[model samples]
Target chain A: MSNLEQIAKLSGFSKATVSRVLNQSRHVSQPTRDKILAIMEELDYVPNGNAISLSKGQTMQIGMVTEGINEVMLPFLNSFVETASQYGYQTIIYTSSGDPKKELQAFEDMRRKRVDALVISTCVNDLALLGSYCKYGPIVSWQRMENPQIASVAMNQYDGYTLGLEHVISRGRTRIANAYGRPSSINTLGRIEAYEDAARRHGLAELPQWSRTGIHSIRQGEELVREMLAVEDPLQRPDAVLCSNDLVAAGIVSEARRRRLRVPEDLAVVGFDNTELAHTLGITSIYNPIADQAKNAFHLLLAKLGGACEPQQKLQYCLVQRATT
Target chain B: MSNLEQIAKLSGFSKATVSRVLNQSRHVSQPTRDKILAIMEELDYVPNGNAISLSKGQTMQIGMVTEGINEVMLPFLNSFVETASQYGYQTIIYTSSGDPKKELQAFEDMRRKRVDALVISTCVNDLALLGSYCKYGPIVSWQRMENPQIASVAMNQYDGYTLGLEHVISRGRTRIANAYGRPSSINTLGRIEAYEDAARRHGLAELPQWSRTGIHSIRQGEELVREMLAVEDPLQRPDAVLCSNDLVAAGIVSEARRRRLRVPEDLAVVGFDNTELAHTLGITSIYNPIADQAKNAFHLLLAKLGGACEPQQKLQYCLVQRATT
Candidate 1:
């Protein structure tokens, strides 16, 4: 007889019960699990991980696919890994580098590996393509996509942008230009809507030329500010600038300081993603709450894995005021 | 007949050749592999991942255990993941939170999961304990431990510290203080040795109390500088300060600026790790070649997996001067 059968026979338990104990199922009673485990130990039955996984129909692994591995994503990924480990699951991470083809390849690879669930921060906007994979396992996205099949967790970007714009206005700045991230992202779209609404409400002109896109890094911020300063028309120049993130804001501050321009007196800067860069540089920023979002995403995945449905979650954001403004 | 036997009969090849083709072994010729693959496709046979792994004694997975998941380690981890994926391997990451017990637990968990190899950035200094694990699989450490059994990749910390110190001295700053990370770490020990040696070579008194430890953050740097500035004796005050990392240096600069003290005139500051933080703050820092070390570590693991040994490698460090110095 096989070792599993031997353990079942010696422990006076059915084969299914012995299998449950081997898989560490909660249905098995403590004493029964102890008896079965002791018998298996005595018989020197070293359980094969692959064999056990095949039998149980579960790999105890979660696959995480992101557009890129960066400082912005590191804290979220770290929190998710920690939470997943606490639930006795390991995570396998893949980066798609913002390519749709590579993202689909990652999904296919995760399917073949038979991970229990998938958490994706996708660069692609097509939900139909993501929905077709639901047959394999549950998926949790980092963006708030309007799909009935996929669960999601995201920060309220519109409110975050509103907070930054209003803070600048409250600080007595009227002529404000904006620098934001990729134009195609839902995050950027939401922030743009907020910015337009705030400009209209505050009786400020919505200058399409002043608001720029594709500003994600420190160097980009510096370049954008230099370009703004180059316009000899002082009226066209922005008295204040709202940046896509803290990195860009730091760039603007650094470059502005190099020109001997005093912050708040010459230009007020507002940044997003209140990261450590914002704190150290004392740039007023919008806190993204990425760790909380990551934790919520894991809990949503758990609910789905347990054959339950959970409502999509949208977390809140706040403004952190500092020296730059 | 079993599927393997049927494939062997139909293809007129031995079972070993069919098994070798199934495992994607390089020994199989192209024509033979294509023919076998065509037949297998015609039969609609999908290979099971678990069964394939069990039969081949390989998992095609690598385990990465880090002390903590922070911005400092993110770049290294990202590079390693990209390189590993190029070689058809996925990584499983675990963070030990700087606890030796948790580190050991991660190792045991990886062993039970049967990962093909392990790469660790450990907090513990016990090389003997690490050497004992070689019987399971090859281990690559991020620190340069003097063990012939394990492969290692590390930056020359002494050289990195020397570059920063010498740069400050070249800029005419003779009275310099130091604020660094954990004293127990080899990196810190190496930096301290360099600092003492440089001070002695220049015929300067090495004030034991001036070189402070247990500093790894911006707040600590701020606190250390505040304490230093409070001393009434201007003769005992340092003309310059070398920080352990960019974050601490940024803190010193920020705090000094808050007190209206001019940087590089009243107090010069140097930082290690020429990260984006350093660049944004314009703080002069030492450039650590983490990506090179990660790539080299993977190549070492590849050699070991191919039944060969490799020598440990220590990458170089250089200084990048900015306005702060």
Candidate 2:
């Protein structure tokens, strides 16, 4: 039998009166409500959350979609989950595994589930398609989209790249080489644009051979040093290298030490994303405030839910100087 | 007006007929059903998922609770989510942040939400309380609990410790020290029992000063070497150290190299959790198959949902030897 029916049979009360108590309707007498609640506790009964949410016209749940997670996104996800939980919202996570079709399916699932809001950590679909999803609920993207209708909270990637480049240049190191991730990624494209702009402003010729893509790991950093730095003539090699992240910079440092090359004297290295690995290795890096961005993203979605149209927000990054430079 | 009301009005069908069509009742004529469905498509009507689920007697959702994530739990969570998603189950996450009260509250939330199953990554609550929750849904714990009523999937810590110790013994190291995480933790307690038993069997003296607790990070490994290994009498110190994890092992190796001490010949280091950091730093570690454990946990929960009483599963660890040993 259903829980309400059992309660009604035991309390000698009608099902409608029992439901009135469950819904906290003032029409029910105080004694009747107390008796129904006591019987509920005795039976260890839990009311249907779905029914309650349906009556309230809100689910009090958020749907979060990501292409996939990496070291950079891990803490952000954890922080976002914690913050949302504190506000009484449960986060349903859907990892698309870098598939655009899967991301679209996740949205469809959310729409059918009727979540209160949507948070897109990664999206590869067209902006117009994403904007159309706004009808289902308020949508927020972690990456900046050109569509004004979608709320976005993202870090300024161009400024981060410029920070790393300027720090190396400040140390009087010209002829700088660059190591980056996938060329097609939005972040990498922004960095490439900033690198070229900085090189032109500094009157430094951009050498195609000096720039390497798909450098994400420490081993990749070491490989970059081997392929570009170990030249017959020392002056032919770049004096400084700008890495995609701390792992790549760590690789460069380890490789340089193995070859008995002095850092800053023989080669200056700058890394991005000041992770603990960067701090431990003392590599100069650009600090990306991922935790802060995650917290703000939750708040931005909350604003959208509150019927406020928030403008796109761009957070900043700063350079943390350390032993490498 | 509600989407259902609009669809009924547009199709010129009675509300009862519209709901019957929505529920796929054969009593509704084919032409009437088609007309209703067409109007639904034009109105972009998404049926109330909660109401549909209420009638089906299942949520098609799972609830996962964790006591805050760490490097070890991150991949495990991702793998579990991906596996669950592939099976058409949406995962709702709640992070308790190591608070027992919060864990209890999360259980209450899951019970109200009526998730099909519950996955507990970490819990410090009483087992009897968790056992009582079985009425709400099946519960699967990542950590091993003494309660036979709750399903669990955990790595064999004692065997893992023995594997690391035996490997070091084979390398001709007699006096070995140990670095561990919180002494009160179940994993550490198991390791302590294994270490004493192995020492007694091998006729090696168990020195109190050789054991260090709360050693988790790379910096702690460096500090351990500085405190114990910098002794003037080389014979008085341990020839090798067993680390709590790869981060500690990496620290030991880095500090030893900085102090001009050769690894293995001077201080052999064995680590746990065979992470990529261990591979990059070349530390011999006991490989804990977290991804496999996560996948198995989901399958075990599925078995529970199928009414199968599964026994507790203890996964094994293997030693991966590298340059550090």
Candidate 3:
């Protein structure tokens, strides 16, 4: 007889009772459970994978963790949701609020929900903890991290910035301005690095007064420009600006108009994300293939969950020049 | 003894095998399965709800269906995701490209995946079809429909336009233009009705040239204006514009600058959705309290799924005037 049958007989109970106990059923009395568990332990009984899967069937779910879906995330999210469903998997969303404790809690909740995998975006902190979650299941991110277990689909944001910088510099924009979301974030740091590299290469001086950080919204983007305009020194001001997002770029453009600063002639500008606002306003901006990124991320998670691991995916990006440059 | 016990004894099999057969296990022989099923039918054995929930335990997953997320849905989506998670439920996103067959297919798929509930946004054509899906589980929408089975949290989008109309009219503007996503959509119709009402009350002429349909984007907003500008009759052109969305409003502002039209002086403009772009561009717009709408929709779904049905919620709106008006 098999170990299960032996345990059933030894415990003076049916196989159903032993099975229920293994599945962690509360109906089984403490004495009966203890007796059956001891017998199973003595026999070195291990529950089969089929039994576990039968109890916890395919949820066909992929959980998404993000730092609360913001403007740049919205379009990407729409594409991700559509693309993920197309892949025969349902997509679940969890907002982590970028808090370490809250992020870990969200991860734990996703695990308990038996999500097939997780796709995270812009993890400002708690990356190590997030990386540790890969052992539990497939984990993919928007960052191109070095870890092999955790896969990612990332845009060439840094290189895209360089292209933008070169375009603006070529336009004779010597005093360049820029903005950042979280100055400390790896994404922001990398972008800042590329800007510095491009500036040094082009022999353009980096003015501290021109760059701003901690800008979170379009209003702030306008305020950032207003602050730039407030400075008394004519030579200290930026001849052109590059924004972290299109919303901010739109804000800067609006504010520039309010001050009667002619675009391109008075001050050239560029925006990132290539959102609808960019196309509408005719602003030069970086176009990250958001839909492609979503598709790649979904496929990456699908591959990892299917037990075929792939390396980190780096998606392409470009500067879409309109009238702003 | 219970029917299950009687069926097991009559089949001359252990309860485990009988239970497995009922749960659709392939381990049992055909003869055994037929015999056991026959016994079960004869005994009228009914499986309890706990058994089903155990098999498809609270995936805690709520599938969301939308007619493809767009610019207007972004703020609502962000809040919906955050609010749903706050109420101890995870959110799943499914984008139906507004295709009737595709939407129904998505619904059936979500049902197969055993999502606890579904929340839909802007069902333009497939509403009745979507309404029929309430029988499977709880269905909530971003519309306050007459169907009770499909609970909703809707915005007063009609009143929002009226408010916009009144604000601009109060500011001594008579020739007003408006645009929409799908001109025939219920949302657009309601807004149009309010616009008509407000126009009559204000004794303003309804120039057919001023009200354009099928304005899908900001570029379209500008195109609408350019089309207005093309009209040889100066009397037919609008003195102010009321846009379907803030992106469109921003576009009008951009286009106005291109034509050297001073806003609120030459052509005042108002927008809906009150997005960051609206505030950035200093456009007068309608604020729909999207976060509140999202929270109410989530709670309504929560109540219905938790076995207590709640009435549909109608969220209010307001006109926020800025430099543009």
Candidate 4:
């Protein structure tokens, strides 16, 4: 006889009664169920419950590994959580601030905790570590990685920047510069590539001094613009500036205004994200469809975990024209 | 004989090996473990493993129920998750958009899943429903509630607004108006009370047209400011506009600037949140101590869960004066 049968007989209960208690059914009397649970607890009979549950399939749990703090983090997480809830799945969130060591630990913990899948939202340079974690479960990345094993939802940041730059160039401005966070980040690198392409296409000379990188805050934007404006050379001045975000663009606008330069007419500016601030300030911006990206990422992960291997997705972005451009 | 004896005897091995396999111990050989697991699976012996595990204690899981989308959600979640991780706990998030039924479901789900604790970040008017869930686990709220049973990390929004409004009044601006989110929300109500107190104390006649309600976006700010400026009565015109957030202030600033009105000189504007945009645009605003609130909320919840009773906490906010005011 099996261990379950032994427990049933020892408890003086039928196998169905024991099973009902195990399943946490409400039909069983409280005292009888409590006595059975006490006996089972004493025996230490269910130590491998999590593993057994995983083998039985469908924990209804999705793991999300994110950097946890970003402009996109809350919106993406909101969309993902709502969408996951619609599919009767609960989401477990882990944030490591892009730390690979912590990310590995998160993967290990998620595996031990028996999550069905993982969505990696943070920008990670380490591909091997991410690939190794695939052994634990289905892994989906927010960025488009060309890897066949890992699925991705790619953001069309390159084309978006290209379009923004083209808009600036078409408006008869030749001297252009870009400032953004972390030149090493993949998105920034893509933007840089697009910036170079636009400069080359428009026959605008790329000023080494004009290309400002490692700019993260509005204060940085003010400092950078002031530094550029302090340039004594007239020919070296950028006629137009493309900022990493609305805040940076706002800083540039304020500083330029302080110098009595009219926006668009004197120093044209374009910002990214098309945030509420961008719209309010009438800033030309690139709109990354955060909600769409979130939905697609969740669906792709869900489909993969549900036995259908969905292809990697690439979402589109739009350039919104406003007063600044 | 018990099921343990039956399984051990049936496998021609000792109960210790059987127990090791059930515990997922690496000490047992792969083949032995696999054979024992197969037999257990066939017999449906591990069905009550989850219940047994719960009784054994410490699932290391904490459930967070939020409204999912808010300016504060991402930043708050970042702090909560990091703090939870420090305590060796994993967070499962549920967002119901303030739906009480779904929140009730979340509580039930958390209880059924055997989560050790719960954190409620969503705003709910009903205290009775929340009180009912206290039996499931230790519960902590993110808002200031009068319930002695529920510990909260309260935000001093009332005093924060009073301080902001008083600053505007001190700057010799008589025609003061307020703009904010849903009037029904507790935060906005507090702000309204402060607005009234400021207007009454300063002996400024309340202009019906000056008070704008249900303003949520930058566009709304622009529209409302435009509407205010269009008012024919000179006595009703607001000289200063206090916005719900930096985004709104940006909108008011942009609209005012569009009509050649100099900020602070002609029209004073103050925004709340002191977000990056506010700094970039040089808007005077109130800074909500997000990180401090997050830390305190986590510590409050942690203390309650750790069997140490912590009193309800109220974090302070400060007004940051910049160029716009």
Candidate that scores best on DockQ: 2
lDDT of 4 by residue, B221-314 (tens): 7887678768787456788888887768878888888877678887789888777767767889988876667667777767766744455455
> Highest lDDT: which candidate?
2
**How would you encode candidate 3's per-residue C-alpha lDDT over B234-293 as one tens digit per residue?**
666788888888878888888887887678787888988898778777889999787778
Docking class of 4: acceptable
List the candidate numbers ranked by TM-score, top first: 2, 1, 4, 3
RMSD values, in order shown: 4.7, 3.3, 13.3, 7.0
DockQ of each: 0.50, 0.57, 0.22, 0.33
Q: Judged by lDDT against the true structure, how good is candidate 3?
A: 0.76
Give candidate 4 misplaced runs (Cα > 4 Å). Answer: A1-56, A259-261, A307-314, B1-56, B259-262, B307-314
In order, the TM-score of chain B in each prediction is 0.83, 0.88, 0.78, 0.76
lDDT of 1 at A11: 92
Worst 10 residues of 3 chain A by lDDT: A46-55
Looking at the true structure's interface, with contacts defined as alpha carbon pairs within 8 Å between chains A and B, what fraction does model 2 recover?
0.66
Interface RMSDs of the predictions, in order, are 2.1, 2.4, 8.5, 6.3
Clashing pairs in 4: A3-B3
* Positional deviation of residue B265's Cα in model 1 after best superposition, in angstroms: 1.5
Residue pairs with backbone atoms closer than 3 Å in model 2 (clashes):
none
Candidate structures ordered by DockQ, highest first: 2, 1, 4, 3
**What fraction of the true interface does each of the listed models get right, in terms of native contacts kept?**
0.59, 0.66, 0.49, 0.57
